[model samples]
Target: MRFSREDLARVRLSAAPDPLWEVALSITKLYRPNVTEPYAEWAAWTRNVDDLRVRSAARVLGSLIPSRGYFPDFLTPADGSPSLEEGIDAVLRTPRRKLRANLGRLGRLPGWAQGLADGDPAALGSLGTAMRTYHDGMLKPHWERIRRRLEADRATTGAAMLTGGAEQVLSGLGPAVRWRDPVLEVDYPVDREVHLAGRGLLLVPSLFCHGTPVSLADDDLPPVLVYPIAPGRDWMRASAPERQLEALLGRTRSAVLRAITYGGTTSQIARRLRVSPASVSEHVGVLRGSGLLASRRQGRGVVHSLTGLGSSLVAGDDAPWPAVNSAQPEWCRPTPPPS
Candidate 1:
């Protein structure tokens, strides 16, 4: 049981957890250092657990081999003991030419990248037509983005948990991490356990966002979270409010939201809603002028969407919002019978 009766009682106290939950967890694990609690390892380890493996990161790498990088005649163990670092390096350090050559081998027009393509390809390939097309085409740029993200991922406590042998090869370049010292301080119903070295300090900025008190740590880079618990106290607390909020955002249907949600820029939103381009533009303009929506142009045709207040109303929330959705557009929407 990761949670207790008393801990569970305080779960709903947060109004709006400022930091992300992963940031919260990473902070807790690094500062508090929980050793006992029967299931700690499983709890932390599962974050990167290869379960969702629609295509493992390696698979993503393999896909771009022919076009982006050179595959060394290297064979490494897939199991836990071999060290995750070696595995990643194998993918990362493979000679670029080899990767490009290998890519040339497979479905040159491969519908399903040999499980090694990183990010989106059709989007990346437009940038070039090189020997290491996918790698140069897709993976390399994504890796740069990924590298920066990994740095942020390693910032809070990414150092200690060496995924493979990454730390061994790049000593000093390793992540900054430490065992939690006693006398931990924390925010309750916490999305993450805050772990600090020593303090009656009463103030340590949240690791992820220095400006805000830490909420939770889900680690954006390699996508791992840390949990800090002193030898005991294995209790579960609902994560920071933002996690739920993000999840809600993630689940939100953008197209449906456009049609049902209200705001501005009918042309921009209309393109998205798949309704008559003009009709979408007209309705969005109405919503905006009527105070049912708010919008800002993000370059691609002054985009539109519902206002905060508007979304709540459409979401069935009574936060005093104007009706954003008009009669659903006729093109894709179900037709109503004549009165």
Candidate 2:
């Protein structure tokens, strides 16, 4: 596939991240094993694990997302800062006529998705619930690391474009893309060309997209190119809080602490640990009281992250730490254990 740029001024770069897109693309790993190496450990760790809720969700969403071919563009919007609930609302609001047209174009959809065309409220609600369930189970645990990689990619891409030009940044996107003067070529199963006639383009970096960059099937929607970002070996290290913490706090609480290394809310922590939100809240309260965790209110929920004391304790305990303020010592940054 090729993207035609009438002029250098016609090209644009964006680094907005969305959770729904991650859910849509990451589900592909469940069915496509060949490209799962980078995520193989995570995939294996999550497979057959308890959490029947996420499993049911996977089946429902799996049908919506085939191994190939076009799915609904509305499912993965390019909103700058997207949340699961917001994405669900968008999906529910999709016009019946547009939903049927998109689904019919894909030949046959899953029963749940088909029910959506018939305006089944249950199916719509179920799909939304399933998506949240899946996100909580599969993606929330690794979100901190994922977010860091995406931020790094944005910084690098932005710097490249500033130091050089759009041509340099486009050529450096990944091995799957090429810049040939006025057109940007990408390796796609389907042959097509998108003319960015002053509309420019939205460059989205994804952790789940393996090789080919994905674009919307509809030309009318804002053009977006979702490409993959490689995670370093350090980022691939498994999450294991210090054995001492486990002994001190018990296994479940210890694992919860490790999952919140980069900080998360009660629902996110609960989803990651596969425990009840109330349980997580209780433990978080205990940890906060102990000065091992700090809570900040964001929107309707509180975001829990490690305080400096908490960071020092986790570092001493030998758990993975997220990035901290630059003023802090080197011990605060996440580093792989010495071999």
Give per-model TM-scores. Answer: 0.21, 0.69
What's each prediction's clash count?
A: 59, 0
lDDT of 1 by residue, 1-339 (tens): 122333223222111111222222222232223422422332233232233231132233233322111222221111111122333334344444544544444435344433323324542332122223322222232222222232233332223324332222122221323212222223333344433212111111112222122221221111111222122121222123323433543322323343434233555343323356666555555567756566686767575656775565444211222223322122211111111
lDDT of 2: 0.70
- For candidate 2, report its TM-score: 0.69
RMSD of each: 20.6, 11.3
**Candidate 1 runs further than 4 Å off:** 1-99, 102-279, 289-291, 295-305, 316-339
What TM-score does candidate 1 get on C-alpha atoms?
0.21
Q: Candidate 2: lDDT of 322?
A: 45
List runs of model 2 lying over 4 Å from the truth: 1-15, 33-35, 78-81, 239-339
